[model samples]
Target: LNPEARAFDASFEVLSVEEAVRVTGRYAPLADAVRELIEATILTEVDGGVVDNARAAIEGVTESLRQRTRSAKVSYRVDGRPLPLGNAAVGVCNPIAPPIVVHQEGGGRCWSEFVLGLAYEGPPGLVHGGVSALVLDHMLGEAASEGLSKARFTGTITVKYLRGTPLGPLRSEAWIERHEGVKVFARGTISDAAGVTVEADGVFIEPAWARDGQ
Candidate 1:
């Protein structure tokens, strides 16, 4: 490949098809679970009927996923916070959305924030590497799922740990890089009083099934 092409490819942080397949397998169940919530809510007596059903479905899926996948999780929507789960990043953040806010997009791009707690320890008083990755993944994933771009799961994510994250308050941010066909590309990072501890790049897929308008 030419230097320009190589630079573009290098900039992408692309993954192999096999790698994409593997990630799809890992996250497909989560997507399906969300669909189930949408289906089940069809019969619920929501106030706005259609829109209310959609909200219930979204909230239900987030709650269900939080319960099953999160370790120690706490979440809140417009309503209020719910029972906390263990080891959950959102649960730890104390501001995570229950119906899993896809996309840090409350209003627009550039989503960011921080957290500090006892559980996310690594070196002395630093946050753990895995914990940093988890937070970045969810933040990136949220941006992916945002209505602006219909990204499903991360096809690939590359993270760099530039420094040790402090155990105190931390900040995180995620935003869309671009979109190609059914793929939505995004980037995110986590930082703290010390500095930028982690940087992340992600490719999110809209999924084959989602194309059917599901």
Candidate 2:
């Protein structure tokens, strides 16, 4: 393990990789079901009765789950260790997250492949610009962390949308460009079969907490 990563881990409650997988896996199906429901709600034209029935069922489930809500968020391993189950971008248990699975390639690079359904649609079958930015931001931060071998937070990110990103299968790639002191600079792109549609550059900074631990 990278020394920096190990040091950072010392500051948080670390769970066994198996436990993380099991916990995330337990929720994975629920997330997928919700994703399907979202897409279906957007695309399907149902009667008022059907809509009311669905709404009532969902409300019941929500109330039941609310009874078991945690009082505080747990600080668990995120940066490619086990799984970031609560992450908004790449969490398997997050229903709102696109189906993005990030893979760390050699030489400070990270890649993700995913598909966007109707729930992410904007501008008539195209992906929203903000959604593109969100994906790039997370990808660039992952690259920065991989480059520095430590967790990093987004300092600033600039995204350029070259063309309309269609709502469907897409790929993103990010890599570290350089680092200075506690900041890592990274670049990334979202591409389709034709070519790149979005590009981004970002600076990631080591948080004060992690730096203090070091």
Candidate 3:
């Protein structure tokens, strides 16, 4: 074993790809957000029947942008900051991103501000409960990956609703919580213009596919 690579911590119950997808979707709101993000950002106007196909399109766009725009770095700084195009596209697939303003990014972390459209509304005027989870998951997942590196993907997530998150003018933040070797944890929150409304915790696994990258 290459001891320098990753010191063993604890092993978790490995969920098959299908099982993992199913488990995540149990929070239906998160699932829907993922679907939206995929359709809007990753796939763009192109219609691809499968996830991998969409990923390919995302890669093409990002690579093209990098090649055309970057100086010596082979990657241009969008909005005065490096943008992992594919990653951001994948990140925004979350319906929670809504159509609003994403803050100019810095380092590995990013923040977004937007209003929840009617499509995402739940509980009278408030955003749907699932939608909140979806937002947290998306941001947390992005934070887990940071830039260039693709995260293993979320394994488990724990969220505290706190107070009902409102639908409009919300701000969200994402950052890495901690990493126990292959497992990455991140924290994030949804807040109205007034104050924090909900908080979340996510456990992202550096899956075997990404182990080589680590």
Candidate 4:
């Protein structure tokens, strides 16, 4: 089986897909509310009293959450099946993760469609350069691993900014160019309706732990 399909099948052994969806569904609304709060914090022009009240309300929620025991793992999961909760780019349960879902596009390609809001603004209405890099890095790494078929981490990545990436709807695509031994080389681009605004190339390598397992 292809790497991606194998990974999916493996997930079922730990947590059925239906249960995974149910768990994530519970967290999704909370994450969305926090995401909206981020945008409102960036764009809202309310009075000081309103801001103070909002702060107090948020602090109360934070304190309540803190009272609960925290999980040791950085990422959330159901049994051994990993969830993208803490992922910075496309995590549905990560409030700070941009509103994007990266999906495989057959072959070794991966694609994402997303929109950046005021919370991600940089350079007066443009998406932050660092954010672009984060997304590209994630996409390139996904392609390199064939959507997590094999465990890999980025060894090197080079991004070239062709133009300003606007703070709105955008498209990202990445594909594996080739693989050599434990190394995979990939290329990717971020584009708006006008055209490509950022392009990147990266090399990903299997870590020692993963290689040893093989």
Backbone clashes counted, model 1: 16
Q: Mark the regions of model 3 whose C-alpha exceeds 4 Å error after superposition.
A: 1-107
What is the C-alpha lDDT profile of model 1 across 93-139, one tens digit per residue? 23221222223445324555554454456777787788788887878
Ranking by TM-score: 4, 2, 3, 1
Clashes of 2: 0
Worst 10-residue stretch by lDDT in candidate 2?
A: 70-79
Residues 1-214 of candidate 4: C-alpha lDDT, one tens digit per residue: 3343343343222456787788678878889999999988988999999999999999999898788653543334464445666678878878999857879977789999999988888899999999999999999988887776667789999999999999999999999999899898999999999999999999998876566642
Clashes of each: 16, 0, 1, 0
Write down the lDDT that model 2 would get.
0.82
- Stretches of candidate 1 exceeding 4 Å from the true structure: 1-87, 91-110, 147-151
Better of 3 and 4 by lDDT: 4
lDDT of 2 by residue, 59-163 (tens): 999898788754244446644453566567887878999858888897779998899877877799899898899999989988998833576989999999999
Error of 1 at 115 (Å): 2.1
Candidate 3 accuracy as TM-score = 0.53
Clashing pairs in 3: 37-93
Off by over 4 Å in 2: 1-12, 78-82, 147-149
Pitting candidate 2 against candidate 3, the one with the higher TM-score is 2
